[model samples]
Target: MPVTPQPLGRRERNKQEKLDRITAAATELFAQYGVDDVTTQQIADKADIGTGTLFLYARNKGELLLLVQNAHYAEALERGRAEAETIPNVLGAVMAIVRPIVECNRVQVDNGRFYLREMVFGDPAEPHHGQALSIVARTEEAIAAALGRHGPIATGDAATTARIISAVMFVTMAASVNASLTTAAILQDIEAQVSLLARR
Candidate 1:
């Protein structure tokens, strides 16, 4: 027989509720006004929590960026996975996996720039650092799965090739946000890179 999942206790439930509220509020405010322009007090007010309570969740704006984007990135990964399944080639498949996230970045490029930077360089001791790692791991898994479905890529494990594809997509996305390149131009560059890897 399958084991039943345990219900969350009151304290755990309350903590999760606060976390959810803060994530929702931050995602909205950051998407609308951009991360650099938003304040912790504004996020607290939006979440209906005291500044002190908000501090318990995120020590500062940088942590808040990771907290907010982690959920969005997870959602993007899921969407990318589904889209990747429908694509015929590994290049298209990988692009499918990255498109949602790249689009999210396109909306508020400044936040995307800072958020990506933080994810890349933030101290591992931070709570959201783990979340970012988990999310990225899932994305890489999605790319590998997509490549598997599309058929064999050139020699080497799909996971390793997927890592290269992910890096390319991320670089393209970062350039789109920070370097003022058009998404189309960045995607074209990504396509050029993918052709060599996927070798269609």
Candidate 2:
């Protein structure tokens, strides 16, 4: 059996609550008003925290975007897993595990820009960067699990195959964003890649 982890201390839990409040407020504001138009003071006000206190969690609006986007990405990954379970084919399964996140980015394109920038180049020491990597890893695992259900090509060596598939998914998403392509086009490209990969 897996070991149960220890619980966070009271102080740590309180800190997490504060972070959650700020992220939730930021998500609402960013979604409703767009990231560029939303101010840090507005976020602080929505969170019911002092301006200075909000700064303690995130240095500025960009970092605040990271916090909010991380939460959004995590939720998307969970949704992807549940959705993936209903699909029967590897390509469709992979799409089920990735489409939610792609659509989330599409819905929040402005923040998606900043979020992708940070994901590629932000300081790995930062909390959000680390958290984002963990979320991506989990997503990769989900993709791998779906592939495992369909073919020996993936299940024969799950870890490396998963990473490769995840990389392909990320590349498809990045290309879609950079080229301003429709989601249908992006999924078509992904299907092509997975079809080729599945045959190998």
Clash pairs of candidate 1? none
Instruction: Please report the candidate that would top lDDT against the real structure.
Output: 1
State each model's CA lDDT, in order: 0.82, 0.81
lDDT of 2 by residue, 150-187 (tens): 77754547667778877887766765455577767776
**Clash number by candidate, in order:** 0, 0
Span of 10 residues, lowest total lDDT, candidate 1: 174-183
Model 1 root mean square deviation, Cα atoms = 2.5
Q: What TM-score, computed on C-alpha atoms, does each candidate reach?
A: 0.85, 0.80
The TM-score, computed over Cα atoms with residue i paired to residue i, of candidate 2 is 0.80
The candidate 2 region of ten consecutive residues with least summed lDDT is 170-179
- Which ranges in model 1 have alpha carbons more than 4 Å from their true place? 1-7, 176-178
